[model samples]
Target: MKANQKATILLIYTGGTIGMIKDADTGALKAFNFKKLIKGIPELKLLDCNIETVSFEKPIDSSNMQISDWQKTAEIIEKNYTNFDGFVVLHGSDTMSYSASALSFMFENLNKPIVFTGSQLPIGDLRTDAKENLITAIQIASLQEKGKPVIQEVSLYFEYKLYRGNRTTKISAEHFNAFTSPNFPELVESGVHLNVNNEVLLKENVSKKLKVNTNFDDNVFILKLFPGINKTILHTLLHTPNLKGVVLETYGSGNAPMENWFIDEIESAIKRGIHIINVTQCSGGTVLMGAYETSTRLKEIGLISGKNITTEAAITKLMYLLGQNVANSVFKTIFETSLRGEMND
Candidate 1:
């Protein structure tokens, strides 16, 4: 691969709806060969970008995606970092947000575009949108202006919109546009023309080098606070054996009951060195933990506010940081900061 070539794009097929095909005889979903992608979509020739694909030995749904899968994606990028101008990840919708969010954090100081795209329908079917999505994703990946990458961060390009991966969430199950990022603004809106929200996009460190950290420790749990919950239940959750982190979904603005049992359990978790991340249950607003009296007790403890970070981003960031074996103190401080443009910094 020549560095001076117009552009080189790497397509990483991690398995998902885009690769699904219904057998003519049995009508069952099966992974189809991506080699036929260009054959089916002849329009790819207009892209004018050098593209190559790498797929898993046996494609699995995103629900089956594991730490090993993330490790594989990171390895691909690492091996071809200098050879490719950008990357596009084909993933299933079920866990697309989670995986994209995790990659946003795992890849630090990224200079090239890492755009994740997949279709709601299979590529082989008639009236399928896979060709358009995949083709446009490649265009977005190789897009440039003034000899600099147009997008220099990890993002999700779906249904003509590009969003910061960590800020995005899968909000729709039946529509082609299945993702939403209400807290942060969309980076690119593809309508009559590709409209990019340049201010919201992240800038790369021209001097710093690319860094990839594939280690992801998923030893975490989520506890949603609801009314009529018993004290024993709260204790059981906070005292879970071998707990490393927790994503605590609280009421509006991260407010939670100041009841003695609730406060005690959270405090105990903090004392035990468990990283407790407080995020608002509402999809739009941030977690202002100390903004209300009801949440003062939680702030009195060491529970950290996730701010405008989405639940998907929170869990993935926790997994990535924990896997890095970072110091407890550093993890506590960095969790609230935007490391890879995953949160509003």
Candidate 2:
């Protein structure tokens, strides 16, 4: 890694406040040409990297982000993976976490940075935080250690902090500091000097070639449990046509009512080959099934524990695993285990 060498970074604009500008007459925010972005922020030219920009023909808002978009994004990465040292994804703040999480699982044996970032206010706004986020994201992606990419996994960078992508959630709408990885620690912190927590970063396996999985089965749904939830509603949802999996957002420690009807519905669903995963509704914590009598039946009934996994990650993991056609016999075991460093053991 010669100091004179420059990392070649690819900036993929997928539509977000970071790439938005105010319409002169309409006064509404609209997507701008990412190719001309570096001109507005000349600071990007000063970075120790060679940057190239690409944009979605019709950039979509992150809220409108779907499986198809994930597949396209992955395809772009796969096609250009060899030519670029790292990738910076510009996505809307709203659903950035979900996209990031999905991409993490999509790229198997990834050995380069896939950094997602966005701003709360439009980049053209006077008070915007877009420039800092965008600049830092690129810098983080282009980082190298001993001539190799340092951040070799999907991640989200906002407010000067770099987080494991799947672990982040949009915690604020108006504030510049919008995303938070509640259950995970910051991978890097940017202050006067960029700080990389090398110990916590994902270890790269350079020996394996990158493999992309774009087959995402959308035959999944999330069921957030609540007090006095009617069995009829639960039954209806669990019986959704072609339903393959469900991310059950349960109470503390994955507990639920011990009523016979509730337990019966769960068992019935499981028996029918519908995967049920128990994830905590709390912002931060692991699901400790069977810790209480209320949760004992859930564990006994074979609900997979989503230990410290965010809802975004849980739902996407369910979709990814189902898409992979994991054997029904080993699905439970695999679901409980952390894939792509997405959850705690």
Candidate 3:
């Protein structure tokens, strides 16, 4: 990239509230034609960048987003990797965190920005926040130093903050601030001027070429523990046919019941080669297995600690790792280590 070259950005509209417009005929909400986006938001013409648009043939709501949708998004980025400087993914906010986390894992050695954003209100609304969010996300993606992109990893830009994709979780539905990064700080903040926290940004790996990994296994389940959970439920879930992994949502610091039946069921599952990950139910803390007496048995029985990882990241990472056909013996070690900064060391 030369200093004199203008940035080229790709806007991918995958059905969401942000892309909806009220139909004059039926007064119903419909997906906006992204090809005419500039006409709808003329402010885009003022930016010093070349913008291109693409849309899903049939837009899907975020709640209905599936693994195939993730693969399609990855394929889109891979297809245009060399042609575009950055990508702004307009997705529904309901499952944006999940999609963001999945994309973060799917791309390897990425050196360009893949920013996900959406709004609570439609862009056609007079008092909508969609305009600001959309414009700022593109601006953030267009930012560069020297001749390279400033953001070099998958991120989520919402309201007025930019957070690492895997670190974010949706915290609000009614408010404009719809996302939060519980275990990590934001990478950038929007205000009078865009303030980037360069210290937290992922350094670009220019030595490696970008690679996309679309393999994802959906044979994993999240087992959330609660008081009075009985043996039958535990046994039945663990005994599910062809189950590959389990994300055990334990109590604070990864603590679980110490009952004999509970220990027996968990130990039997592990012995049968089920990979169980211990993560805290708390939103803001790390899972410290063996930190207390209640968790010592779990550690001894070979539960992998999900250290400060959001549940969204944990499940997606599990699917990614499982799809890679990681060896059973080394799976625990690899999962405990951070492959894409999804968890603390």
Model 2 stretches astray by more than 4 angstroms: 1-3
Clash counts for all predictions: 0, 0, 0
- Backbone clashes counted, model 1: 0
Report lDDT (Cα) of residue 339, candidate 3: 81
Q: Order the candidates by lDDT, highest first — what do you get? A: 3, 2, 1
TM-score of 3: 0.98
- Candidate 1 scores a C-alpha RMSD against the true structure in Å of 1.7
**Model 2 steric clash pairs:** none
**Any idea what lDDT model 2 has?**
0.92
Clashing pairs in 1: none
What is the TM-score of each predicted model, taking all chains together?
A: 0.95, 0.98, 0.98
lDDT of 3 by residue, 194-213 (tens): 99999989885799988799
Between candidates 1 and 2, name the one with more favorable lDDT.
2
In angstroms, give how far residue 176 of model 1 lies from its true place.
1.2
